[model samples]
Target: METAFTPFQSLAGGALIGVASVLLMGLMGRIMGATGVLAGLLMPANLADWSWRAAVVAGMVSGPIAVMLVTGEFPQVQVPVSSTMLVIGGLIVGVGVTFGAGCTSGHGVCGMARLSPRSIAATLTFMLATGVTVYVLRHVMGG
Candidate 1:
């Protein structure tokens, strides 16, 4: 429940994220939304663009894995729920991925970078929904 990250570590992580976002947008002219990238990979018409998207996703995934392998500093995750609950949560997230027209990474990082109004709305919705969900599940539902 408690994070072991020092203030410096947290700040460095935030800085790295910002740097990566800037580089990704400036260099690729692409939104770094994991879901959209993966969806592009799944589309037959997007075969020509698959490699870059796949690499982006791979790099994002592999970066953390590499860190854990090298430093053995994997962060702990605590989810006080059953597999069924997790599955339900996943389904809800999937729906959000579809309805929101972009995932948090896409809207928060990429859209915000482009100064998009839709992205701003989407990001606010994500924050508000997450806060409300947490409150309901932890307090109202006594989960």
Candidate 2:
């Protein structure tokens, strides 16, 4: 069988994520969503409203790098599809993030923690959309 993450490792990762989320919300009053972060960076107009976005983005980009340095074992990344498929999937995700008002990290973690109704709705939409997409790709499209 293929090697998989140990239970303790999974728990540690989850705990780290939870701690980081709490710290971000408590300190910066911001939701750690990569899509929104990147969008804000590209626009730069929104940077005036929030000064810490740069640091937040930097932390996100650096976290994995730091982990890699410590562990010395990079996770395997598999891309089973073509660049066109990847681009299409990315565009769809972007559209969903915009329409839902937040991505998975924002709604699934932070908003859910805060008991936000909009976040609940957005999270559900994201899940449903993901399920449908997977079903279509695997069964209907046979990809």
Candidate 3:
């Protein structure tokens, strides 16, 4: 399957992510690692921490709502795979995150911005794995 080249949209989205992460770091002095945020939400250290985490999560879940308010329609999403495949993929990601200590949003975005060595390594590994996965799925496995 051919991938669509959405440079503008991708740039805008990436900029938003960078701004949000920078704002979070600047205002709260916290790195905006999504998985870390979610985990903190699950068991917060205190009320202040919980409130911020809740707000971050709220913003995350309300993204489509914000788009609908601005564009007058919810963003369209497409999922080509079955629910089982999605679940399997999620499980695989969970295992990877557990072993890697954080997700791409954390390492790729926040960690790299901080010039963290571990994050740099993790991001490289993530990129390499993604390229290999895509190559195998598209060419080797003929998916």
Candidate 4:
């Protein structure tokens, strides 16, 4: 089936993300990277840091719920893979985060925004890898 493209919704979501990132960095002195934030919870420097990390995670989880409550429907989601594949993919991503030192949100959004060379390189690598993977899957493997 054809899906609807909502440019206004996409723009609003991106604007909200930008505003939240700025406010987070300005007020809390933290980068609004979900993986890094979640990782911090696993290895917090001090006890006080845990509270804000928990709150951030809680907010992430609650966002979709809040949207559903306000709109009376959840956003459409389609997963073509099996549940086992999903779990395995998540585990692989977790391991990748450890090796890469950060995930896409950390390197692509927050890092690039800060004009860090490391992040710039990491984002480029991410895009290249993604492009190659898609090509392999769609063309080579007939996925």
Ranking by lDDT: 3, 4, 1, 2
* lDDT (tens digit, per residue) of candidate 4 on 1-143: 24468899889887877787888889899998888999889999888898888888888888789889989998777887899999999999898888888888888878899998988998898899899988898889988
- Between candidates 1 and 2, the one scoring higher on lDDT is 1
User: What TM value does model 1 have?
Assistant: 0.81
Query: What ordering of candidates by TM-score runs from best to worst?
Result: 3, 4, 1, 2
Better of 1 and 4 by TM-score: 4
- Look at candidate 1 and tell me the lDDT of residue 7: 96
Tell me the lDDT of model 3 at 63.
88
After TM-score superposition, the amount by which residue 14's alpha carbon in candidate 4 deviates from its true location, in angstroms, is 2.1
**Model 2: runs farther than 4 Å from truth?**
1-9, 45-51
- Model 3, residue 122: displacement in angstroms? 0.2
Worst 10 residues of 4 by lDDT: 1-10
The per-prediction tally of clashing pairs is 0, 0, 0, 0
What lDDT tens digits, residue by residue, belong to model 2 across residues 17-101? 7888888778877777767767777676764544567777777678667778989976556677799989998998888788878
Relative to the true structure, how large is the alpha-carbon lDDT of every model?
Answer: 0.81, 0.79, 0.93, 0.86
lDDT of 1 at 94: 92
For residues 1-143, could you state the per-residue lDDT of candidate 3 as single tens digits? Answer: 76777898789889988999999999999988888999999999999999999999998899899889999999888787899999999999989888999999999999999899999999999999999999999999998
How far off is residue 42 in model 4, in Å? 2.9
Answer with 1 or 2, whichever has the higher TM-score.
1
Q: Pick the candidate with the highest TM-score.
A: 3
Worst 10 residues of 1 by lDDT: 1-10
**Position 87, candidate 1: lDDT:** 100
